[model samples]
Target: MGTVRDILQTKGHAVYSIHPDITVFEALRVLVDKNVGALIVLDNEKVCGIFSERDYARRVIVKGRASKETLIREIMTENPISVTENDSIEDCMVKMTEKHIRHLPVMDHQDRLVGMISIGDVVKYIINEQKYIINNLEGYIKGTR
Candidate 1:
């Protein structure tokens, strides 16, 4: 039941982004260097698109486009779905499942990009929450208060 703001607070609001004009190869390098599965495409500090390993596989490799030659703008998912800090983690899970996406960019009230969350992040948080609930239930059953 935690919000995106809680996740950002725990994980830190570090957003990795790239320009659309960059080559897919360059973007891949950034992905590898940052150890993230996706990058937000920003133009003039505005969210424009998103590039992911899935994008590279489906858009570049499947289409026989060379990463070194293909620009990110040519393959990135334009107008990607985003979530606000106030949105609940469960809401994000539903959105991601419905959209068939693994990553989401977190935005502030002003529509400024604040962070990014992956499916792994959400799953981990939910699992931890469940563990806490179970522990509390067991403690209550034992009259441990």
Candidate 2:
């Protein structure tokens, strides 16, 4: 019965991002330092795209481009799919499955970014919910609420 907001509360909603103009080198540093898989690429405080490790491997490493000279925007996934906070974890699971993305940025009803959720978050919540249900069932069998 927990919500995405609940999971975020335990994990923290801090998202690491960078400007589109930043060098891949700088972006890589931030990614490594933050220990995150992706970043919300910002332009004037608005999201333009997302940069992930896959993007670097595909666009820069495979293409033989120097990370130090390449811009993050060039390799980021443009116009990436997004989700809102009101959306159910089920809804997010469906979207992520269809799109094959691991991270989803949660927005408010007004479309302002609020938090981000990863596939791991969804799995954790689902697992926790199952455990809670099983415990409740055991308690019920024992004539407890």
Candidate 3:
């Protein structure tokens, strides 16, 4: 219904990132500290990959790799699908659905990381929009503005 810019404006652009060279164990600590589901993996201030709980469950735990010894670069999702600030929320929903991803990194016109959006964020925005429309329709029907 709205653009990524709208979402960012509502929820502030605070992106937590980690270096790819960090160990999975260290990354997990950051994840816990940040209370986030995923972290943007940056290499020399450039977005390189993403590390999430899914990566830990499927890549490290399932593969019998030690979290303390394995680096994020080894298992993080590389070249992840991204969305721009101008992209519509519906477009983001379609991309996330098609990719089966829960999170998307947002970039600006200069390709600079601006923020990250989660499936939860999109769902909440849609729900609020629907509620607003329903309220307006009810108000109009009742001649209440």
1-145, model 2: which lDDT tens digit per residue? 5667877878887888899999999999998998898999988877888998889998999999999999998899998788865677888888989988998887777766777888998999889889999999999999888
Instruction: Give the Cα error of residue 125 in candidate 2, in Å.
Output: 1.1
**Which candidate ranks first by TM-score, i.e. highest?**
3
The positional error of residue 2 in candidate 3, measured at the CA in angstroms, is: 0.6
Better of 1 and 3 by TM-score: 3
TM-score per candidate, chains pooled:
0.97, 0.91, 0.98
Stretches of candidate 1 exceeding 4 Å from the true structure: none
lDDT of 1 by residue, 5-112 (tens): 888888999989999999999999999999999999999999999999999999999999999999999999999999998999999999999999999999888989
- Local accuracy of candidate 3 as per-residue lDDT tens digits, 22-49: 8999999999999999999999888999
Q: Which candidate achieves the best lDDT against the true structure?
A: 1
* Cα distance off (Å), candidate 3, residue 43: 0.9
Better model by TM-score, 1 or 2? Answer: 1
Q: What lDDT would candidate 2 get against the real structure?
A: 0.86
Which ranges of candidate 3 are over 4 A from the true structure? none
Alpha carbon deviation, residue 84, candidate 2 (Å): 0.8
